[model samples]
Target: MSCVQTIQDYGLRSLGFGERLLPREGFTLCEQFTLIGSGIIWNVYFGALALAAGFLLATVLAVAKQSHNRWLRKPAEWFIFIFRGSPLFIQFFFAYFLFLSLKGASSFFNPFTSAWLGALIVLFLNTAAYTGEIFYGALRSIPKGDIEAADAYGLSGWTRFRRIIWPTMLRLAWPAYTNEAIFLFHATTLVYFSGFPAWQQKGDALYYASYFADKTFNPFVPYPIVAFYFILVTLGIIAIFGAVNKRLNQHLPQEARRKLRIRPQVIR
Candidate 1:
């Protein structure tokens, strides 16, 4: 088949569109690209939704961790420590098992066993803890003089936090937050590999890549294709986050603004 025909046949294959069975034999370059590209929709879905939900939760976590009251602070501290100290792989396994046990208890909990809900829950909490630490550090690093300035202006409690403290914390944390965002996207590939089963062969980019590899005994082709798609997606993330980071740092002098860098470390 022509390249155009192959693309047309498999472009939306992940969504149960176009080609139904995938290229069984004679897997062309066009087939690999189209199928893997189609699989990317899952990655984007997991990453984007998890990031959006995690941001709000992280903000609350950061605030709670910084609270003077022990009731609020201790739980937040323990949460951050627990999530951040453990491996995400283990988290995925434990979460899947936990959900499985819950499903055994009742039909209502069965939905938690599925990839869509289970993976999202794990990713959300993981990202929240990581981003919470970043925001907490930024909150602590907020210049002491800023608080005094807020006090001088009679900006107290919610008003002070809303106007001055929160903005500065986000500004300070934006660079690290961008790094967290990138890692979270990469982490989505782990979902299918974990305990969550990819129902109906519907899976992410890495999932389909692994499937092809096992079938043809050729890791070289499929894995590289998966990596290429991830690289493109990662670059797209950097672009979007870079724009937001720029806006966050816009008020500062050019030299004072933090430059975003990618340093993948063990946060999950």
Candidate 2:
């Protein structure tokens, strides 16, 4: 088939919207690119939803961890510790089985056994833990003078937090948090490879790349395509985060601003 025909057939195969059957024989370069690109849809879905949800939880976690009350602090501390201390792969593995067991208890839990929900849950909690620590450090790093300034202005409680503490925490943590966001997207590839099974051959970019590699017995081509797609993803992430970083630092002069430095994590 022509490349255009191939695109039409497999462009959305990963979403189960296009051709149901994967290309069987004599796979061409167009087919590989098209199918793999389609699979990237899932990666974006998992990363975007997980990152957005994780941000809110991370904020709460950071506040809880900073609380003097042990009741609030201890659970937050342990939650972050458990998720961060263990490898994410193990989390996905155990989460699948845990959900599977819960499936017997209620029909509502049925969706949790699938990658769509189960894997997303794992990603959400994992990123929340990592980001919570980042925000906690930022909270601790807030200048005592800033707190005093807020107090002098009669700012206290939620007023202080909303006007001073929260924005300052975000500004300080953003550079590191940008790195976390990038890493989280990269980590989404682990979803299908982990215990969560891709139903009906619908999978992520890595899943399709692996399929082509196994079928063609040539790892070089499809694997590099996966990398290319992710590189584009990384670039898109950098662009978006960089804009946010700029806005966060807009109050300061350009030279005094803390520019975003993406330090990709080699080990997590």
Candidate 3:
């Protein structure tokens, strides 16, 4: 097939539109690009939803961990420790089985059988813990003067946090959070590899790349295509986070603005 025909067939294949069955015998470069690109939709979905839902919970966790109240602090600490101490790949497996066991226990829990909700739950909690730790460190590193100044203004409790502490914490944590975002996006590729079924070959980029490699016996072509798609999206994510980081530090003087840097994290 020509490039245009391949694009027309597999462009939206991830959504189960055209080309019900993936190309088998005659895999072309066009097919590889189109199918892999289609699969990227799932990556974007997982990362975007996980990051968005995790942000507020992560902030709450950071605050709880920092609280003087043992009831709040200890639980928060344990939650963070449990999630961050273990591999996310392991979390997905455990969560999938746990959800299956509980599926019939309640009607509200029915959605957990599917990857759309089940895998998302795991990713949300996982990213929340990592982000919480980052925020906790940033919270502790906030200048003592900032709190004292809030006190001088008769600001306390939520007033102080809303107007003073939270903003500064976010500013300090923004860089690390940016890296965390990229890492989390890369981590989305593990969803299909885990217990979660694609439900119809509707897997992510890596899944499609592997499929093509298996069919064509040319990992060189499909894998590079996956890398190309990931790199493009990763750079786009970095650019978006960079803009947010700049706004977070906007109150500081030009010399004090923290530059965003990409430091790839290795889980092992």
Candidate 4:
């Protein structure tokens, strides 16, 4: 079949459009590309939503963690430690099961057994913890001179934080936060493979890739397609975060501001 025809058949298949049944046998390159590409929608959706929501929560957690009061600081500290210390894979399993058990409690909890809500919750918390740590470190490292200047100018409490501490925290935390964003995007793939079942064969990019691999016993074709899509996504993320990072540091001399770097440390 022509490439166009193959895409027409399998494209958006994850949404229950186009072909109702996936290719049962003799899966072609075009089929793999189209199907996996269709699956990329789910990945993008999960990553975008989780990351956007996590950013605000992370800021709150970071500030709370740095609070002088033990009541505020201790909980935030333990939260960051627990989530950051555990493997994401294990967290996925544990979260899925925990949600599963909660399903019987209410109708609202039932959605948590599915990837949409289940995976999103995990990704959200995981990103929050990582980002919180980055922000917390940045908070501590904010030059004392900056705070002194803010105080001297009669800035205090919320005014001081909004004008001085917040911007500095963002500037210092951005590079590491960019790394966390990339890792969170990659981590979205683990959702379907974890305890949550992909209802109606609706799965993310890695899910469809793994499906093709199992069907044809050919890992080469499908996995590479998934990887290529993820590379594009990773680049897109870098471009976006780079723009934000630039804006955050625009006040500083070029040499004083550090460029955003992608360091691949394990999240947990």
Candidate 5:
């Protein structure tokens, strides 16, 4: 088949559209690229949803962790610790079985066992713990002078936090948080590789790459395509976050504004 025909056939195969059967033999470069690209849909879905949902929970956890009240503080501390301390692969393993047990109790828990919901939940909680710690550090790092200045302006309670503290915390934490966001997207590859099974043949980019690799007994071609896709994703992330960082620091003089320094995690 022509490359365009191949594209039309497999472009959205990962979403269960276009074609149902994967090509079995004489795999061409175009087929590999098209099918693998199709699988990226799941990766983006998991990463985007988890990142957006986790942001709010992370902020709340950060505030709770920093709170004086023992009730709020202790639970937040343990939640962050448990999620952050364990390996994510183990979390996925445990979560799948846990959900399976719950499925026995109630039919409503059925969806929770699937990767769409289960893996997303795992990623959401994982990112939230990591992000909560980042935000907590930013909260602690908030300039005392800024708080004093707010107090001088008769700002207190939620209004003061909403106006003064929150923005500053975001400004301080954003660079590091950008790194977290990148890592979380890259981590989506682990979803199908983990305990959560991909229904039918639907899986992420890594899943498709692995399929090609196993069939051809050649890891070099397909794996690099996966990397290329993720590299583009990383660039897109950097562009978006850098723009937000600029806006966050827009009020300050250019010389006073902190430039975003992307330090990718070598080992998470």
Candidate 6:
């Protein structure tokens, strides 16, 4: 089949919209590219949704952890510690089974068994803890002078945080948070393998890549295709974060702006 035809057949195969069955034989280059590329949609879906939700929860957790009250601070600290210190892979398995148990208890908990809600919740909580730590550290690192200046202007509490502190914390933490995002995106590959069934083969990029590798007995072709797609996505992520980083830093003096660089070491 032509490349266009291959795409038409498998472009949405991961979503089960096009090809009813993946090619069992005649795994042409076009098909490999098309299916792998199509699978990236799911990866993006998982990463994007998880990151959006994570950021909101992370902000609240960060503030809570920074609070002076033990009631607020200790719980946030424990939550952050538990999630951040553990391996994400283990968290996935634990969450999947926990959700399954809950599903048995109540019908409203049904969605928790599926990847959409179950796996997304795991990713959400996991990333929130990681990102919350980042934001919490940034909150602590905010210049005392900045807060003093805000107080000088009669700003306090919500007004002070919303106007002076929060923006600066985001700006300071964003590069590291960008790395967190990239790591989280990479981490989405663990979802289907965590015992959450793909439910009609609608798995992410790595899922389909592994499937093709297993079927063809050729890891070279399909795995590299996954690598290529991931590299492109990593670059795309860097670009998007770079734009946000730029905007966040634009208010700073020219020399004060830190250039966004992908630091994989932070994740490790």
Give lDDT per model, in order: 0.90, 0.95, 0.91, 0.90, 0.95, 0.88
Candidate 2, residues 201-268: lDDT per residue as tens digits? 99999999999999999999999999999999999999999998899889988798888898887535
- Alpha-carbon deviation at 197 in model 5, angstroms: 0.5
TM-score to true structure, per model: 0.95, 0.98, 0.96, 0.96, 0.98, 0.96
TM-score of 5: 0.98
lDDT score, candidate 4, position 147:
99
- The TM-score, computed over Cα atoms with residue i paired to residue i, of candidate 1 is 0.95
User: Which residue pairs overlap in candidate 6's backbone?
Assistant: none
- The segments of candidate 6 whose C-alpha lies over 4 angstroms from its true place after superposition are 265-268
lDDT of 3: 0.91
What's the TM for model 6? 0.96
Weakest lDDT window of 10 consecutive positions for candidate 5: 259-268
Candidate 4 global lDDT? 0.90
Cα lDDT of model 4 by residue, 102-135, tens digit: 8878778988888888889998998999899999
TM-score of 3: 0.96
Better candidate by lDDT, 1 or 2: 2
TM-score of model 4 vs. true structure: 0.96
Name the better of 2 and 6 by TM-score: 2
Q: By descending lDDT, how would the candidates be arranged? A: 2, 5, 3, 1, 4, 6
Cα error, residue 177 of model 2, in Å, equals 0.5
